[model samples]
Target: MSSVSRTSPTLATLPVDMVKHITDYLDIDSLWNLACTSKVFMEFIQDLKIRTGGYHVDIQKGSYRIELPAEHYCYCNWEEDDDYLIDDLNKDFKDFQSLFPENIDFLRIDPNLVRNFDRFHQECTVLSIGAHPMEYCRFKAETCPTEKLDLLLNNVNFRKGLALNGPKPLVTENKKIFNIDWLLIRNVTWITPEFIRKLKNKIVYLMGTESLTEKDINEYLKDLKSGKIDNRNLQVIGFNTGFGRPRYDREQVLNGLDTTQVLDQTYKVADYDKRIESELFIGTSSANGDIKIFRSFDFNRDDGTKVSVEFMYRTVRVYIWNQDKEQEKEKVTKKRGHAKDTNGPAAKNPYSHHSSPPPNVYNCGVSRYLLPGNIDYLLIDPKIAGKFKNVMDCAILSIVTFRKGLALNGVIPKMWKIWNIDWLQIRNSSIPIPLSMLYNKIINLWDISTITEPQINRYLLDIRDGAIDQPNLSLIQFRKQSGWNSQEILSGLGTVRCQERKIYKLKDFDEKMRMDTFLPFGLDENGIELRDTFDFVRRKDGVKCSVVLLDWVVRVYVWNQMETKKRARGHPEDKDTNDATAKKSCY
Candidate 1:
């Protein structure tokens, strides 16, 4: 029999600092095992403990002591040795948990070490899976609750050949009991739709080499086209060159679809000097056939070691279907300015609701006559008529002109007359104006006065001065008072007034009103003619009489035949010399 060495390797055998450095990479199980191997290893681990204490407990002389309120417990350990550490440490940890009834908030075991989860019961909330493929697969299938699992795999093999078969039994058994929150896979290449389905509530984070055979790509495309795959649930997909030079353009990598037998996609590519390291894609699709893609790129450290990295990101185009059905539905249900009355079918007597008797024949308060189809014949109460006479005149004229196919200018008075009807109350009582009539009146009045230059200017001024305050003032009131209803007709005028005020406040009157005083007809300094030419004068026989004041003032006056002859002889244009001199003197 070969002689076996009794003394196992200890921390003293290696540099203490170097041994501590190695512990950083070892998982929790390795650390626990290292502590259990010997007194020296245990002492070293205790002395080099990395956790900063938020809560503390002191078990002096073998008696357990609680020092803080316990909500949950999390433990992590690391060690250098495998055999002496892993096997024994797991056994002791389980035994210790049984003796100590405190709850475990989360339990993470190194994949290299065997796990006995039956001892912990429901105490475990979080677990980690490492690069060991067989061990990870077995742990997921046996110990992990499918729905509750928080899988963290770093530099792990998740290729087609190494993938787990079907849904793990544990996942199926406990899915109703819990929901998976997260699934982190690093340096993983193959992830299937089935795998995604199994991890429904879980958000997946994937990194590393990404490759899909042409067949697989075609299948994915088929699913996208057929609506079998719900792309809305797919939150993110990312790709980046790892440890090697970029073999393909980043854009080609993202655009999954092929055009001209070449895939053209857009991707955020990191700089080469930055040593492009990783990429992250995030966001989900919408139910209405919309896909939102968010992409980010990371830069590797220049030192070639694991260090701080920089990331840049952008959201690319969103894919959506043009939905005409919604627009069509909106159009069908949309409300218009006028809708057919729904109180009842068309009235047998449309004029039965008339407020007054026919206008051509007054019946006072006794007889109600049908309102004539000809609005001019409709009778209004005397009191109302008196208040809205101008408005009525304007309205009647407008209706007559409109019916006669007259110009718009002739229809304004009729519109104004109808608008004035709003103030036609019964004595002291307020009479509600019919919305239809009021609208018609407004439309007519707007058409008439809106076209005139003087009316527009006055309207603008009234609006600017806030003279029209009430938005619901009656037209009858406006006409009787020589003003528009402050309430009903002035709300729209506020904006116009504000703009006019700003312009007027900023305008230069002196520069704009410059005058010229050189011409025969009262010309000002700015060369603007103040009077009409001789052609504008009225002619009587061969002589002309001034039709305007300025023209009259500019005509030459000859006291006698000799003076007239002299003036005529002097110059044909000298007839207005006196007027021109007068204009200059006035200036």
Candidate 2:
């Protein structure tokens, strides 16, 4: 018999799983070579689940990198490889595309190197034109990746005669010029209605259109209203008249619609030196209900030094976009099951007077430990507890406990009677809650920030007249940023001293003052410091108190012999031994 010829097994001869595992370890160039070797390998490479890092090549630097996920990269310094061919660069790039036709998401290419971008335009999402200085030049590509390429045009000069009719034709059908969704044209003083009519974009920003007039704007608005062409995709038209003699009455042009004048007067155009003083008019268009108008004026100062050169007059309008209809449609589509609204209240808007409180179940809060139990303290109404869920329970407790107490200078007043509470303890929180919560609940009123004299007088009258049914508040205290409005809260309370005393002198003290005030050490042998103490006899029903006013934390000093003995004996029931906790009261 004869001799037999032997051939090595091809990569495809192995199982697909083994081939996939082997390919995973291969570099970009090796994979590219492998795909080029045979049809079987090409099909295998195309079917491989590869996450492409965009096909980016910096041909100028003779360096390129194929970006991959998870920081795994394959780079080529063409300078190091003497065999690298610059003449066949386009052919090589086409080979990469042919291997993975659906892989390229974005391409950053030098505008000069691209001859007919249309021929090389892969079915991709975004095709960036120019380099860094022109990167802002972006275009939206084909909606479907396999359809065609699209481009985003940014910062491109569109001078009067240069853009529409030039030697190369700035825009052409072979380039698929009409498919752009966003167009940003700068340094253009004039854009004919016909030109604006032909643009198929959802949003357009035209800057430096100093030559544009009110008639042009009116025609544009009218065309938008009539819907002459199928530019329904056209949603927003933004343009600005450059700083010059012509000043359009933007408000007058935008008449016959609901408008709100944003009066802050602080605005500037993007990437320009000029400062803009304009009344931002936000409202729906009278011509087309679906086309909203957010236009502003470019006002000049008396010196004319500060002028607005670049700014879009109009922005996205919600009403014209049928926001309510869309919202209703979304609401219906997302209607899975009945769920309560989590936001505290519902109203027409922030400024609207109509509102209703949130559902009753929404009030559970951050510090549930401090929240008044439904039966124990009755500090908060269970039905409305959900409304105050966001505020610290401790803060509410503090405000409800201390805010209503009698404000006094010499001695603590009969706060228990006024607030219907037996105890008051207060401390400052790391995060302070708003004072309005306390002010509103105690006073039963609103708008605490701008409390007018009349409002204050009226509130005092209501309290004196018993016209307002104040809550049966007890232990009203709050750790606040500012001290309680002492003068306001204590206005009607007459000056009263609960106790007065003169301290007994110690034997060693010449001034007959308390020895404990000057002593750096503990009491001496004679216990002179003990005799220098002053005492106040508590009323039979006096309420226990612990109050912190700003930086000062004040507490009742009870010197009862039996309680001191209990504390010294380590009695578990003596709650006062722990300084951080409050002692429980029978009430």
Candidate 3:
């Protein structure tokens, strides 16, 4: 006789949906029970869409997180259990990879009587995440079932920092997430520009958003200037749209906004001392002048508050300043960095102009916001240029060597040389200004005007023959007068042409610039972007340089970057040269 056998149905045998409903009633111990039962159960538990407290547990982040509490994680009773129990548990902990090495001791200790409740509890708090990975409090999945994130965030104090990183899209109706001490949101593309207009966080950084437009940035700045949005607690706020995106047009962002240019080294924002700029741009110094590197625009409010708008390659930062004003006690937030020295007054970088803005101090190294009272930044009066036998070490942004008098009160003007002047404007100046003026100095960009075509020709020829050797000079320009010949400038130089076709962009600040001319004001403003170029090799060191000869100007681009040299495909000698980015890196 055959007997029919009946088998008991377990979670492993049941549908995955049924398994989730059963686990819903289970505690942390129940989870371990199912996970430790067998290989099938372990994977079954892993696949369940369970979110205990803060973390998704579904995945992880490359970012660092603070500690969460360990409320329900009690010590295990290893009396009858084999070493396999602890082994599987340790293996799971290691898989998370968030646990500290010192906190995990199950593997190194004896299995018999090693379940110390107190230490295990402490370790669990370190490993177990609840509200968020970096939050202060802690809880076990058994304590609270998976619920809405808004409800979870609603219960959190958030005096501590907050970070959201989950693979799934978050659904939160709560508006409170917008205002925190410090916050970081990964995959923040869902965030709207409307949300940005309401940001009150002290330091907020939002990543992975392709929807935020430059127009949004312009409106935000306008609001700040109009007092439409005010967050006294706010210190640093930035939006970094990934690379190759449209640049945050400075002219558009600060359009019609009354701004105060900060000339002093300190760009004070409540004395918070968080040097976020340096932390983000750590790789700044080694970089050549391929780009503008740094530029800032600041303004003061009717309420006496100061605001700074800084624009970079493809990113933007808004800094609110209340120098003597204080805010609430600081909380744990994403630390961009801290100021190098804040104890005393800032020391003037003696050689600031001669080198790359000293690493970590690019903020200070960028030319001051420019004194509003000193609007003649372009024209360095010949009288002032004659004062410093050597002001080489000074943080002089641009020099104007026009035939005029300079007004300097403190130092008592004497005699000076043109040393380490970054943006140089020589009005009514000649090609031969004495090698002493250019020798061993860092002059990255130069604009000379009112010079004859013959003089410009002689200068280019001398540069090729090793007669005019300025290693640190990256680019120099000679503006053409009415009678000048553009054709002669391009053909006279022994040169080569590159293949890449492109349009030029020297549009730094606003669009009100005259598109064709390089006026004296152009030195302080922007330069003409269009150009036709030829390459030349310096006889001295076999170094190559690019010369952009335009109908209106003649520009000699030296210190050609190795990347450009290798990538610059040669075109037919008959074809006009391809392109060159303004502010090409210096030697």
Candidate 4:
């Protein structure tokens, strides 16, 4: 019996409200010990979303890569006491989920763990199997069979992405992993060219291919070019030849592919998708950012669809560009007096979706708002705002006057990639940007500088009246208009007050925060702590949220909880919901 052994106490018998308050002071190890006492305590711990930070857990064979909490160090080894490996492996997996943090950043699974794969289907930010992270193939370790891998993967909803490591490449004709968010597979020779062509994932990185020839890659590129395969889902895909395998014969891959000319430039994965950004840069600096340097030759289909094919050291990649987006990139380039990647003028369509990103046109190191498919922060001119309603896909799109805003000269023609934006903040735009033109009504609006109280009232009325459908929308917030109060924001919504003194704080907004700076974006997280707040439940989603009023801003936050021990006990003075600010005495 170790320190984490079950304690004999009915912490579960405590009052519902008291349970959270009491457990909030416990350290991770203490919480683990308490959870072992009862299933009820285990669930309470899990629901708290303790964020247990991130664990690089090795179930067996002795390895632990846990991101330590600021206050404590954790050391609990199951492998150290696996006296009965056969019967207890499945029990051990369940115990891990029950005792530790549920939101693991990286969960390592190996041959031993998968034997009872049917029993557990836990979700993690990244799932590494037989983990192949290096450039070279494992060549001689026991690879997980494709079927056994599928058993666990098919049921789990991997939030950020998926990964397959190669002890020696395993085989699969078709598995659910192919259709997940990402497949960064090492010892990737098992994924055939036909398999690659059919992948429905957003980002695919087959680490090292054994049988993937240039001709096979060309065929896959053709599928993308011809629209035979859905190009929209697969925004980016790449594969390197196996270790000491044939170096890419660029000539062979390029042969018979109608090549569109490209330039010597770079693109960061971070510029495109925030999820992929975190996935790639895990355990690394945000600066190097798992950069996938693409120096490609363009290939166009007969119908004018284009794909960029780039070759690296024994690696090749195909970036599929949306047709309308490719055309608009040219127009935007021409407007800027910037040189285009090709000599020909682009097709004229302001409202087309683009595939590639214009190298993050801002000074790097500014923190990103952790939104999915994040188009990097951009300062777009209002003059071009009418052009496709300035349809740029970004987590934060800060609007500024053309003279005030700077657009970096991109070597490759830049276009709007129409992925969903999580936030849009408008600061200096003079003209009225229509709500409809804002695409999906811009999930969480921020600036609303020009927005009138009546307009906001109508927007809220529409949601309550079922005139609008915004399921993805978690919140709508802004700095209060002169003389506006929480009453004005919730006029017809008929909200109720849930708690007054319970001032919970949510700091997920730290570094992971607040984007969408065009009109206004809601930095309102689901895990918002509220004091003197009003609560409302959506009739449609049954989701509850709160409206918090301050001197300057009125925030409509989708009511959720901060991790148990993270609740702050003080007066709330700032809008950021930072726990530290609440504790610091202004006097």
Candidate 5:
């Protein structure tokens, strides 16, 4: 304790900056070990920055820098001399030689191992041949001893050729060799018949617009037949042929294929517009015609390109043929009937005096009703007359009759109770007794259970007389009963007779005589002036039995009278005529 001790500076005792610089070159594992040795050294080593090839490392301002090969560094024990001499040394050497082949570069091995290095160089190329001057300068700047350069250089394998020993035997053909045929053509543009022939043994991927015309298709088929093009082993990836939009037709294309045998292989044809229509045609039409007319030979290839070809027209025109010879005979018969009507009697006036009358009596009866006259005698039963008390009530009643000894054959009498005398006059003067009612009444009156043929004929004659304005009666009701056969009724009417001993035939009547009539009464003075009534004298077997004034009144006259007097008036014109002709007309 009395003597002064001389201090020996240990690594730990070294300046903080110096220790940092020393640990900078150490591997990551070694640096970590060093940091655990002491607090001061721990901080120093922990703060050091170390970077490897192509990698960056960061550190604090006071930390060290380490440049080392990452693959060669065993970072766990950097400070151990045995680890430095064996593990790191061999690892750096192996890593250095791996960067170059032995034949391309030479290694400056130890003099004792020079012979072994020469043999190794003959077989392999050296990765790196000389000392790295840049690495040496870096170490020198950090105050590393120049002798360290020699130690670093020993790890490298220097090539004799790189060292000015005259280029070492060239390493001929270093890359791997492969057969060219093994390579495949992936991108295809145009595939010709010749190209297809050459690829008989190889797999070919086809794409793009390979449009073939009818002629071309035919030629291709001919070639196939003559063995010009080889189609064997041909595997098409994407094959398409069609035309552009609006012009594309698939029917023509398919028709061309049908005629020619070009595609012996199963090639998928798609984006075909014409093909769809062709299939529809085959389904709808029975004609075995070519599909050229319906669709255009338009198609698209695998690459979305258009292909087209023209096809010859082979459509079969279907005509409707009449094989029956009797059709002509029927036509001749129809012509004869038409000619008879066109050139027959009364051709100039088909509706002449011989023409049939209208079916309904209303039109003519209304004409008679509108004639100026006055009501003289109201033919009605007293019991029926008592029913109408109110004017409105009177308008609702109607006069209906059923005549016996006719087709209807039943009891029916004309009876009425009504208001609105004007409406009654209009209706009474228009509608006639229905034939069915007449037939039914006659059967009831004469005690006849069934209508005889003559009775049926009589009812029809009465209906016809009213319909034609030949009789004073009006045929009002004859509405066909539900489900009643018109043809059967016509057939019955064709062979019926009337009570007056007159025969009635359906052929004797025309269409007008079978239809109801609608009369148009005029509203003008000219029409009003035409209004007149006549006296009807009934004579049975040449004896004067009854005389009656056919009283008529124009609607306008009633309306005028109502307007002037503010009340309805009877037919004055008919009354005047009735008074003047009563003595001569009345029996």
Candidate 6:
């Protein structure tokens, strides 16, 4: 008894990674045996417990399932050691009780587990109590009372949620539990205005029960839209009539929640000193992606056409935040050097800058840009929204288009919403105009008084002969204006890759181009859209040269097939960078 015996080689002596690897293949019994060896091993098992989201127990059935870290069922097979298993389970329950005092993100309860409910109630943010069986049990020779359901509903321990199979009247016994974050109520017939008024959750899914009235539904929607519900965290709500579609209040529920609207604010040309920075914002209609819209802004060259911008983004939901005074100062400080102009204050010559070129330069021939002050409204267009399947497909189309100089300029509305990747096969019905072609001019006609044909020809020839890159693109008429300057208004030239054939696959060309069958617009003799189609036979070292003709101006695009799809239109990360930089400036 006095002699000390050395313990056998402990697995803890192995490296942590090795220990983890070995433990991964062990059964529940083996792991438990190892855990029993030392406190260190028990801690390691607890790590696995956390990673696997702990155990899920069916208290009534007296059954437990270990949830693996991967969210799959644990690979461990059950051993017939009932005594050992019960002991370990009790230990685990006690361990969790000691670990979480504030709340567990998710918890499930059954009648058998009600004894410990009080001790663990504070740790659960989501609680699910199994619906009591109502069907007549032949073995019992009687129908079960609603005692279990009553107990579940009246349980005071559940903090955030009490999932019910159907809605029930208020229980005075418990006087309601914690603020409900998830109300998965079926048979919504019991739901009333008063019931909805007291409900608080980020997500509410109502099913069955036709007891709800139009007025009560309207009040519910009104409260939801005004952020009076959900602790101001509501992100999604779903309604199902459980029969045919139920009719209730429409107006407030439809357009009341952040309906898209533009505030009364005029965009001055001089306000954008540097070339206009155009951006695209994208949003979805629901958490399930029932609709999506791409919103963008385009300014004219001379800044004369201020009326081009509109406010709408298909079926997408939007949230426009107005920058406070302090935010404006932060923005200015962050984008200091990017302004690129020091002439005068924008207030002095608000209309000095040139507007964008004519409507033909853009797709849809409509500019729906929203200024910062005007972005306070949101919209979820019913007309544009569809089933989740179609919405996901549209999202994919939007993303693929974005990679090709099309960009995303906005954020999704909530956390639970997800973009469906399988829906990418559906192509866009509208052809997107390249933003490069939209912005960063080689030469602006509004900046010059006059540019002659021969000079344009020489400039084009130089670009063709490789002496100068393609340049001098404008929409201005050389002879129409009075002022004449002999010197050429030549900005530095840049090259764009020309291709022998159209590079990527272009689907839905007819629908996207909106081709007129009888009287075609912008179509060549072959009926191809001339602006997007071009061919050049002139080859220097087997490279063809093509040019874009805009009124009296010419912009050449150098043929490079490899670089065709490599252009950076813009990126979603640009917004993040801009935001981070703005925030950093504040700091």
Question: In candidate 6, residue 2 scores what lDDT?
Answer: 100
Give residue 185's lDDT in candidate 3 (0 to 100): 60
**Considering every candidate listed, which one attains the maximal TM-score?**
4
Model 5's TM-score against the true structure: 0.14
Candidate 6 C-alpha error for residue 344, in Å: 53
lDDT of 5 by residue, 1-587 (tens): 59988998777888876555444333344455665677776555434322222111111112211222212221111322432334343454443333211121112222112212222222111222212121121122122122333333233332111110101111111111011111112112333544433433211222122443334434443443344545322211122231111221334334433332222111121111111111111111112221222322333333332333322111111111111223454455655335323112211111112133223311224323333343222222223334444423223124332111112111232433221111111221222433333211101112122323343345443333343222212111221100112222233322211112111111112222211111111112212222122112222211111111110111111111212233245533332222223333322
The regions of model 4 sitting more than 4 angstroms off are 1-56, 61-102, 112-114, 133-140, 264-294, 301-306, 322-587
RMSD of 5: 54.9
Q: After superposition, how far is residue 64 of candidate 3 from its true place, in Å?
A: 12
Task: Please state the error at residue 260 of candidate 4 in Å.
Answer: 4.3
Q: Per lDDT, what order, best first?
A: 4, 3, 6, 2, 1, 5
RMSD of each: 40.1, 27.4, 25.6, 24.7, 54.9, 26.9
State the lDDT of candidate 1 residue by residue for 297-331, as single tens digits: 22211222111111212111112221243345546
- Model 3: residues with Cα > 4 Å off, grouped in runs: 1-148, 151-158, 165-176, 260-264, 268-294, 327-587
For lDDT, candidate 1 versus 3, the one ahead is: 3
Per-prediction TM-score: 0.23, 0.32, 0.32, 0.43, 0.14, 0.34
Off by over 4 Å in 6: 1-30, 37-51, 69-71, 74-92, 95-104, 110-122, 131-160, 166-178, 222-233, 243-587
| Candidate number achieving the greatest lDDT relative to the actual structure | 4
Model 6: lDDT of residue 449? 18
- In candidate 2, residue 568 scores what lDDT? 50
Per-residue lDDT value at 197 in model 4: 64
Question: Can you write out model 3's per-residue Cα lDDT over 332-378, one digit (the tens) per residue?
Answer: 33234322221122211222121222232323222232112232222
Query: Candidate 5 at residue 270, lDDT?
Result: 19
Q: What lDDT does model 1 reach?
A: 0.28
